[model samples]
Target: MSPDRGDRRAVTAGFGALLSRYRTKTWLGGAVVAGLTVSAAMALRLALSPVAHFYYLPVMPAIMTTALLGRRSSVGLAIVLAIIGCELVVRRDSIADTLANAALFIVVAWAVAEACFRLRAALDAAQTMARDMARRELLLDSILTSTPIITLDCDGRTRRVTQGAAALLGVAPNGALNQPFETLLPGFGAAALQAAQRSDGASRTLWRASRRPNGDAALLTVAAHQLPDDADPEHTVLTLTDQSQAEAARRRERELNDRLSSVWRLNSMGEMAATLAHELNQPLSAAAVYLHTGQADLARIGPVAQPTLRTLDLAKAQLLRAGDIIRRMREMISNGSRAFTEERAAQMIRDLEPVVALIGQDTGVVIRIQTDDEDDHVLADRIQLQQALTNLIRNAVDAVIDRDDGQVTVTGRALGAEGYEISVRDNGPGIAEAQMDHIFHPMISTKTGGMGLGLSVTRSIVESHGSALAVSRPQGGGACFTFRLSRPTESEIP
Candidate 1:
């Protein structure tokens, strides 16, 4: 086929498809309008027969027909109307006048048809836009209704809820439309609502609300979004998400962590038992030798001699040392299961003098004790507090054992209004910067053959008494370990 014929066929096919898309009701309405146009035109012509010259009466009906029935249908009606009007009303005295009158009617009818086609096209576009908008609104409504989140929109001035909000609030759909927001969600307080409304932007809060009367409540995370400043009355949008399950899961996780920590502490105590046994062996062996030598001297020179008295005194000192070692081991084995009491800080330090002296003599390090306030007292487990101080002093002595002027000083001072601070400092190389982070962790050591449980156990003991053990480098060049304990009440103070 030729190109022009093919183009014409395509155009005709498209027009037929467009016309077929319209329903029967549209075609019937178009036909009725066309009939009305023609009848109105004929009646106007007849009514104007007695008038001198009324040529434009039919133009109004022609324009109406064109606008309603479209260009093709209105053009056909205009042709027939022009013929009927010219034959019934115009005079045939002059052929030129009759032709002129017919030409004028045809020109007016064609102009009206063109204007109606343009208006119809505009109307079709408007109808298509309306349908699209309606479909989009339906989709949006479906999405909002099907979502799990509870959504509510409130009027800024009246605080009345809409139907969408009423559904979530468990109230009648239309009944909630004009009611106050507080009435719809009675559990949500007026103060919170007012705060949400007055918020400048989106605000978030955790709200606990009961789903039913006399039932356990759920934790809901609510987010409120304030509308723009230019909006009338200033509306706010609220969205609620349930967080009850998440909170419960987090609580369970914390409980599990605490159990794991307890298990770890038990394992650490088991490892420390072997170290305690080895530590006790030295004092126990010394006590046995002193007792044996004292018995031999009593048998040889009797109790009155100077040698016999010295031997008995030495045996007594060794037995006391052995007893102190046993007490420390018991405290460590109990692992904070002991009861607490009000004890003088100076007395606790004084009790450690024998152990400190033994460690200093063995390691060639001088140990000194200083007290700023003699009356300072703390609420703590006496055995456990002594054990913690003993660990600190031992570690300090070991740290400075290699130096010519090795010194370990234990200081007790009154702190604040109701606290006492005790510190153990050593004039030796400070803790290395790299080892500072894990200094209290199990199995982390700086010295050779060190089990690394001393500081960890010491910290555990201090913490059991409700205080933290802190380590820092002193200005004079050495490591200092300090802890603060709450002072005893005035009545309990010594």
Candidate 2:
């Protein structure tokens, strides 16, 4: 129940509590009022002694009034009034007549008081019983409304649709009532009904492929039973337990395990990269040395070998680039520390083309690199930035890997005068609405057996450089991941 509703009930129950405490009268208090009433009756009797001497007239009225006000007090008041009548209406001719009349009046008044008392008691008992039943009814209604069950009549018509069952079907309470049970669920047929009838009181699972009015499918653990009815018919009570939450929980657990396994796999790859970097650096250094020796030898051979010398110099430059790549890779694998450099966006895209090709080589998907017309230069940790871009592009490639017309595009461009933006997009099915929130979250993946770490690591890399990674589903039908980087400050600029 809502907090507001509970507060309202509490306020309503306490509203008259204080007044009720002061409204009750004690037995001593009732006797005090009765004493005052009898004194007034005595005064009226004396005043009428000279006029008419009618003792029974005032006594009868006092007896009835006391009976109505207080039952126990009324009996006492009646006995006192009878004594007053005896003293006031004494017969001078016969003592026996006066005594007999007084006794008879006492008996009649006592009986009248008791009859009124018994009638009042009966009314009080009935009212208390009604109040208790009403309270129980309210409690029962609250329970039934929230119960996770849908009751049906013997004729297979929906009689009650609980709030829980309505929520599972994505409808309002009473929305499916008075409808045929078979029509509500896809498989509530004769066979299922017969199984339920055989269950007696035990539960039996019934498959019902039910879709909500809004078209969202639901999985439910359905059970039916034939309630032993005292009437001429038996009711097939259908119980529905929503299995959506349980399914989601299992999915999440699996994702977590996959992510953990992925993390271990990533750690293993880093160790391998570190070892490979050491091994490759030795050969690359020797190759660069050989290229330098060749360029010098060609230089000494004069203008005849000018083309050869130029080619050797080019080879040496590429070798130096390779060495730098190995150094940065080792640094990133050991402890992620940024080594900022002035990097042209166009050059970065050019450097990524070969890697992009290799990624799509086996998958047969087309991957393209696009850059802005302007050669925008930004100060960034080139290796880390490239790693983040690589992760996003790989994710995009995976998204489109299954399609025959799969296409992945990586875009690096200037965001503004002082910033640059990099985006990876794929022409594949976009992320589901349910998984949108947790896509960047660690240990969450949509792909079967996916480690779910690429996006998470990419987001960390982008955030480390003071930017937020964002995602969107474009109208053209694909997922796009993007982030921005700041330009170098005036002091850091070349």
Candidate 3:
């Protein structure tokens, strides 16, 4: 039905547009019609001249038709044709009467021509207005289709539905129309619909959670608007904004922020740790040299005191171990983490639990370890992986140390045939946005008294395995540090 109406308007619009150009065609049409009509009227008069007096009766149709085609200019041409015919046919005895008759014919022809001309003008104007309206309606339909909005009548039936709403409801646009509010949205009530209709544009709204027709859950924010002094009191417009997209976007933002913050924190800690290590390196080296000299001097002295010599040797070994630990911490900045080897994921987690427990033992924090029964075979530097996991667990333990209900969880799970994902979490206040900026800033340390090297070393180990250590805070109040370790494919395995 709409297509047919559109076709008719198109034709009407085309007809007017075709003749509107200011060309010689209109004048040519007027001249040709005047010549032909005058010729025909002359023949009719010649036959009636001997019988009766018909001055202007034969040319009225010509004037009206010409006026319809060429407007005022055509009407003047038709009047000229009438006067020529009168002059050629009038007799000497009937000159005055012929003159009076010719004058009447000109006036009558012009009036008829004027009416016809006005009718054509009005038709073009009306069609132009109709075409404009059609274009506006098309734009309105496009808007309704893309936006998830709908209109409801006072009878609680859908008056209109957008294309987006139709897809969301699992129905065709027309199929969704005229449906009761309850039918379209299960659990929707007439009272709420009426309340929305009574409210003026966005003053009233509701949140609804319901399964769609396709059995998928949807979260919708419903707001309604009714125009003031509307002709139909029940007519209301409703906006159903889907909130799932918003939630997903926020989750993604949090993950990105966590990863960025983790990188920053590692960089800052590494620089400061290097500074501290530098200051301590020379003193520790000098003490080891002194201890070695003391032990040698005792050995050369004839009779050595065994206990004193043993203490000197142990002291030198402790100094060497401390120096090695400092070197590993510097790896975070130097990218020196290497010596990758195949290691059992579960076994590594089991080995690290004792160290984690010792840290939290006196702090009264509950330590929980979750390891996969079927341990994953991951390609990693065993010592480095252990170092990374220990740092995270240690950090998690520190976060919850002050709380009476302090709990820390260490988890390791196989990632299909890939390898394993390991994480450490604690029930403590999470990192804030402002803290993210300073996380990677050199010299900024979370620890108040002095800087630490654990995080810096952990970052190096995780990065060596081709992954980042990311940290995120859950809504329930906790910090989580996560990283993935992969296994070599059969061909890449040693």
lDDT of each candidate versus the true structure:
0.68, 0.73, 0.73
lDDT by residue (380-442, candidate 3, tens digit) is 876667767877777777778888899999888998866689988889887787876445333
TM-score each candidate: 0.44, 0.57, 0.55
Query: By summed lDDT, which 10 consecutive residues of candidate 1 come out lowest?
Result: 148-157
Q: Sort the candidates on lDDT, descending order.
A: 2, 3, 1
* Superposition error at 250 for model 3 (Å): 5.4
lDDT string for model 1 (14-93, tens) is 55445435412354555555566666776777777687556556546755554545446545665666566556666677
Strongest candidate by TM-score: 2
lDDT of 2 at 258: 79
What RMSD does each model have against the real structure? 18.5, 9.2, 9.6
Query: Which of the two, 1 or 3, has more TM-score?
Result: 3
* Sort order, TM-score high to low: 2, 3, 1
Model 1 clashing-pair count: 0
Clashes per model (N, Cα, C within 3 A):
0, 0, 3
In angstroms, the error of model 2 at 266 is: 2.8
TM-score of structure candidate 2:
0.57
